[model samples]
Target: MSPNNDKETPILPWDHFSNWVHAICVVTFDLELGQAMEMIYPADRELTERERTNICYLAFPDSNSGLMGNVQFHFRIRQCPQSMNAHTRPAIHTYNSNCPTSIQIEDGYLYGYVYFRQVKDRTLRRGYFQKSVVLLSQLPLVSLFTAVLELVAPEYFETGEASLEAACHHLDQWPPPTPATTLNLPLLGTLIQVRIPSRQDKPGASSLTPPSPTHTMSGPPSVLIPTPHETEAFRVLAPVLPHLNLLWELVITAEPLVVMALSPTTAANTVQTLVSLIAPLRFSGDYRPFFTIHDSEFREYTTRTSAPPNVILGVTNPFFAKTLQHWPHIIRIGDNNTGSPSTQKHKLKKASALKTVEQKPGVYTKYRPHLQADKGLVKRLLKGVQTGRPVEVQSALLRRHLLELTQSFMIPLERYVASLMPLQKNISPYKAIPSLRPFNPDEFLGTLEQHGPHLTSGIRGDWEGLYRRFFRSINFSAWFNARYQEVSDKLAELHLQAVCDADLGGWVCSRSEVEVVDMVLRLRSKLPRAASLPPSHPARDKLTQHLHTLFMALPEDLRAVLHAS
Candidate 1:
C-alpha cells in the first residue's frame, strides 16, 4: 500500500456551522399572582390599584456580550404550588397603599425560580442529529473559570435523590460539539523554516528536540494577587454593578407570597451567591468598594518643619469614622510628604496644580481625634452632663486597639497624680485650721456609675487602681481637649461640658444623657450573662444576645442603631 498521507486537511469554518442559544425557564413555587406582581414590579414608592395591576417585569440585561450575539438567554413567568395555601384555595389581588402585594393565603414560602438551558446545534446537513447529557468534568474548559466554582465546586453541591441530582444527571450527558480549531500561518511557516543541526555535525552540535507544548502549562505564566481588581474576570463583571439591587428586590417580593419557612441561612446564602456574582463586576479599588461610602474632602494643611508643610486633606467619610472607631489602628502621616517649592500652595490653587499634590499611597495619620473621644467622654459627662451623640463604636478588633491607647494615657496621668500625692504628704497642715466646705465623693461616684458603663465595668477588680490614678493626676477637661484635638473633638467636648456642669452643681444634664446612661447600664447588665451562657440556653441567657438578633430582624433604618451609639 502507498504510504498513508500524513498531512492533515485544514477545517473550513463554513463546513461546520454551530449556533449556541440559552433558554431560561422560570418556575415560581408557592407564589400567588399578587405576590408575583410585587416581585416583578417593586418600586421605591407605593403604586395605586391601576398601577399595581399594570406592573411591568423590570429585568436587567447581561452587560458583557458580543455585539451580534444573543446575551440574555430568555425570560419566563409561571405559577407553582403554594405550600402555605395548600388547604385553602387562594386568590391574588392588588392591595391598597397601606397593604403590601401578597398572596391571599395565611402562610407560605414563595419561590421565583429560574432554569437555564444552553443549546448548541451543529450544521451537519447529511448526518442524523443526536443529543446526550455530557459530564462537565469530562469536557476541557472552553470558557473562563469562575472563583465561585473554586469556592463551592459542583461536587460539593448536594443535588439530592430526586431534585438537583436528577437535574445534574441531565447536565452530564449533553452532546458536546467538536472543538473549534484555530491556525497561526506565521507560526507554521517559522516552524518549517527553523533548521536543526544534526548530531553528525562536528564541533558542539548535539541532537536535541524542542520541548512539546503538552509538557508545560498551556497559558503564559502570571503572578496572581489577592487584589480583586486587575483581573480579567472583574472587568467582565463590572457592568452589572448597577443591577446589584435586583437580587434584594426579588427576595422582598417573593417573601410575602410564599408561606414555606425559608431558613435565614438559606436566604442569606442565596443573597451572598448573588452578591458574589455582582461584586466582582464592581470591584473598582479606586472608588466605593462596599455598600457604605466614606465621604470627606481633603484640604491642604500646615505641617511641621522637620516634615515639609503639607496640604491637610480632611476626610469626613463615614468609613474613615468607622476606621477611627477601631481602637489601636492609629492613622499616621503618609511617608511621601515631600513638597517642592514649585509644587507648593499656589500650585494647589491652580486647576492643574491640584493634580500634582502627591499623597503617600499607604500612609495614615495618628489617632488624635480618637484619643480625645476616650478621655473626653468621662470629663464631658462630669462637667457638661451632655450625652454622647449617635456614634458607631468599633468593637472586638477595634476595641482591642482603643483599650491600649486608653491604658497608655492613664499610665502617665497616674504617675503625675502619684507625684502630687507625695507633695501633699510632705506639706504639714497649718496650726490654725481654715474652715473649708466638705466635698462629697458620692456626687462624682453617682454620676460615673450612672453614665459611664465603660468606666464602671472596666474598673472592676484590680483595674480600679489604674483608673483612679489617671483621674487624680490630669485636668480631665484639658486632657480630653488635647487628645481629641479636632478629630474626635465633638464627642470629647460633649463629655467635658457634661462633667463641668455636674461638678458645678448646675442642672445642665439633658434627657439624652439620661437615656444613654440607661442604655449603657442595661447593656452592661446583659453582657456578662450573654458571654457566660451556654449555647443551649432555653430562653436567651442575656439581653446582649438579642442585640444582634434584633438588629437582623429590624428594617435597615433601625438596624443602623448597631453602628451608631
Candidate 2:
C-alpha cells in the first residue's frame, strides 16, 4: 500500500466507507515472547464487550457530505510489560491491519469486523495527532460520541429507548465538551488508508472492494485507548462541562467584560453566578470565559507586565490598587485609602478646616489686632477692682462689664483659658464650664470679710488662673497663620516639582502624565484666590503665572478639560 494512500482516496459517505475516520477502544494485553499480544481481538470479541468494556465513541456529522450514516471506529494499542530493573524499560508496539473493517448498520446498530497483523519490530510512537486522540475523551465531543452511539444502538442504551428523540434526550443530559477538545483534532484523514484498484483490475474497478476476512495489513501502530486515569478524569470533569463551555464562550467573545476578583473563592463564585445569569441568553457563537485568581495563571494569558482589566472588584488591599493602576484600561473605583479609618478622618478634618477657612474670612486679621488691647483692659479692670475700696460703686456694674468683654471675645478667651488650665486628674480638657453669675458689692465684701485673708488670697489666685487661661486660648491668629503657611509651603513645593519635571522633558521624562496632572491639579486647588492675596505679593503672582504656564503646556486634550473646568 502507498504511504499516501489515505490522502489520495476521495472522502466517502459513512455507509459507503470501508474504515472509520475516528475511533477509540479499550484493550487489555499481556507480555509474551518480549511482545504484547491483543487479548481481545476486534471482531472475535462478543458484542457484549461494547457495553461491558470501557470505551468511548465519537462521530462528527459532515452536513455538507450528505451522509446520513455514522462512521464507526475503534481504538487499539499493544505494549510489552516493563522490566523490573530500574534502568530497563520495555518497548511498546502497535499493530495495524491491512484488511479494512466493513461497518454495516443492522437493526439500528453498527456491526464491524476488524483483523489485525501485529508488527513485531515496529516501535509504538506518538505524534501530535495521536496525543490529540487521547485528549478527546475529556472534551465535550465525548457527549457527541455517546449521542451517536445511542442513535445507532438505542436498544443498547441503559434507558431502553430506540427513538431519535430518546437519543437526543440522552444527549441533553451529557455534558458539553470542553473548548480544548473541540479545538484539537489530529490529521484525521490520515488515520486510515484506502486502496483504489486500477482500470486493469475489473470493469467495476472504481467501486471499493472489501478486504478478504483472511487478509491482514501491517501499518503504523498506536495506542488509542485512554488510560484508567484519563477515564476517571473525564468522569470527574463531565458534570462541569456545561459551565466550562459557558465561561469559555464569555471569555472568547469579551461579553459582560472581564471582572477579576482578587480571591480564588470569589472568582469561582463569580464564575458560577455569571454562568447562571447568561445561561438563559444562549447567545450563539464560540466564546471562552477565561479567568484566574492566580497571578501566575493570569500571566500565562497576558504578554505584557501590565494587563488591561475590564473591571476590578473587591480589591480591599491598597497595594493591589497601586499595582492595578499600571494597567491602562483599569476602571478606577475610588481612593485607595477610602477604607482606612485614619485616612478618612484625616480627610474629614482637612475638609472641615477648609470649609471654616472659606466661611470665616480674615479670621487671623480680625482677631490678631485686638490681642494686646484686650490683654491690657483685662489686667486694668482686675487690678482696679481688687485695689479700690469700692464702697460707693456696686459690684454688679463691674461684673456686667467683665461679662460683656468676655462674651465679646468669647472664642479667643476660651482658647486662652484652655491653654493655661493645668492637666487635672479625672477631668477632660474638652468639657464645658458654666458662666459665673453677677454679684453685688455688699455680698462680695461680706463673703470676703467672713473668710478673711485666706479667702482674699484664694479669690486672687482663681482670678489670675482664669485670666491666664482666657488670654492663652484667644490665639486664633497664630493657628490661622500657621495653617496658611503650611498650605503655602506645600504649594511652593508642588510648583517647584512641576518646573523640575517640565525642565526634564515634562511627562515624557520618567514621570507619568496622569500623576503629573494630578499633582498640578492639587497645587492649583491649594492656591489662594488673587483677591485674598495682597496686591503686590510676589508669591501670589508667581504661583498664578506658574499654574497658567503649566496648564497651557499640557496636552491639548488635558488642557481642554482643565480649561473647561
Candidate 3:
C-alpha cells in the first residue's frame, strides 16, 4: 500500500485481502550496546525478507501512525559485533527522513510490537530487506514451511507469523532478545543440599550460651501463664533455625512482635518453610517467661526454673495470648485475628473449652499428599474442605489444612501447562518455553512467519497459552502480595533475633543486612535489554546511580564489623 510497495499487486486473493497485520513499536531500547526484548507471542515457521518487508509495510503504513494497542512485544537484541557484515547486521533497515539516524546492530533480534488490524492506509515504503531474497539465501526451509502453512492454515498461521516477520526484519533495531531478569534472593529450600553443621552438634554448640557476667541470674517470671487442660490432646512441632555457629535465636523478648503480622497464607508459608529447613524442637513444662518482671519490690512469690533458651517451639493459642501480654510488640504469626485484642479473647475462650471426637460414619477422609502433582489427593482435599467434621487440634493440623489448600491450587496450574505442548511434557505447557539456544536472525524470523498465528493467540490466551501457567501471566500483583506476606513474617522473626543483645536488653542493633543488598543485585542481573538501554534512559540512569550509591554507602569495615557485632 505504500508508494514504494504500490508497484506490486497481489497475485492471489489471500494476498489482496488483509490476512494479517503487525505493528512494530519499540518503546525502550539502548541501540548502541544491544539488548534483549521480552516478548509474548505464538510460534511458527519463517518468512522471506520480502515477505517480512511486505508485512511491516502494510502493518505500519505511516511512521507517524503506530500499530494496534494490544499487540506489544518487549525484548532485547545483543549488540552486533564490530566489523559486522550483512549477515551479522540487523535484518530490518529503515531510512527515516526526519531525525538524525544512528545504526546500531545487535545479534540481529529486534524488540517491538506487531499489530493485527482489520483495515488501514496502504501508503508506506517497502523496508530495506526483501522477504524473497532473505528466504532464498538465508532461510530456505522456514520460508518454504511458512508458505505451505499459510496455504494449509491461513487463519492459524498469518498473524503471529506477520509479527515475527516484522520483528525479524527490524533486527537492525540494535538489541537482540536473549538475557532475562533474575531477582536474586538466598536460595531458600536449596540450602538443604548445601554443606551445613550437623543438627545434633548444632544444638550443643548453640547451647553453649555464656553466662552474663554483668547481669544477675534472675529466676523465671512469677506470672503464671494459663496452663492448657488437654496438653496431651495434641502434639506440636516447630522449626529451629539452622545453626551457623550462632546462639539459638530467641523469638519471645528477642525482637518486636509487630514484624510477624502478615497474611495467613504468608505467615503459614513462612512457618512451614522455616520448619522444613531446621530440625524440630519442642517446648514442655510450665509456660513461663525467661526474664522475671518485678513490681517495685524485688520479692517474687511465683518463681519457677526457666527452660534453656535454645529450644524452639510453636506458640499455641494460650501461649500466644500470654506472650502478647508480656511482649506487647510480639508479631502476630498468621492472618487470623490471633493478636487482635477482641479476637484474642474469643480464641482464648475457644482454646480453654476444647474436645476431641471420633470420626463420623460414612464420612470421606482426605489426606494431603507429599507432592503437589497428585491429582487424586487434590480431589480428596477439596472434598474434605467442602464437607468434613471439624477437629480441635494443634498447629500441625492447621499446617496440614493449609498444605491441602496450596496443593489444590497448584495442581491445576501444572495440568494446564501440560496440555499446551503434549509432545514436550518436561517443561510447563503454560509458559513460553525458550529454545535451547538463540536462533539465527533470518531463521528465527522464518520460524515466526510459519507459526505466528498460534503464538499470538497463545500469548493472548485465546488458545493454549492462557491455560498454561499462572506464572506466565503478566498480572503478578496477587502472587507478589502472597509471597511478600510470607517473606515479611519470616524476616520479622529473623530480624527480632538479629537486634537482641544481652547488655542492651532488646535494644541490640541489627548487625548484618546483606540479604537486602543481594536481593537488589539479583533484580539488576535480570533486567531485560540492560545492555541495549541508552545511557540517557531514566531507568538505566536510575539503576546506575542506585548501584553507585549502594557501593559508596557501605563503609570499608561494614561487612566485617556488622557480622562480628
Estimate, for each residue in 1-565, the C-alpha lDDT of model 1 and write its tens digit: 1111232545322211111111111211112331123121111223334222211221111112111211111111111233122222111111111111110111221111111112333554322221111111111111211221221123222331233233333322322221111111111012111112221233122233343566335633222212111122212212222222222222211211010001211221222222222221111111111111111111111112232111111221223333222222111112122211111221112112212332212112221121112333233222321243211121111223323433433444333333222222222211111121222333433444334334423322223333343244223433433333423333333332232222211221332444443443444444443444466653233344433433444457544654585
Q: How close is candidate 2 to the true structure, as a TM-score?
A: 0.16
Per residue, candidate 3 scores C-alpha lDDT tens digits across 151-185 of 22222224434544443333223221111111111
List RMSD in Å for every model shown: 29.1, 39.2, 33.9
lDDT (CA) for every model shown? 0.23, 0.28, 0.25
Please tell me which predicted candidate would have the highest lDDT against the true structure: 2
lDDT of 2: 0.28
Model 3's TM-score against the true structure: 0.16
Which of the two, 1 or 2, has more lDDT? 2
Q: Which 10-residue window in model 1 sums to the lowest lDDT?
A: 283-292
User: What residue runs in model 2 are displaced by over 4 Å at the alpha carbon?
Assistant: 1-511, 526-528
Report the lDDT of model 1 for residue 414: 34
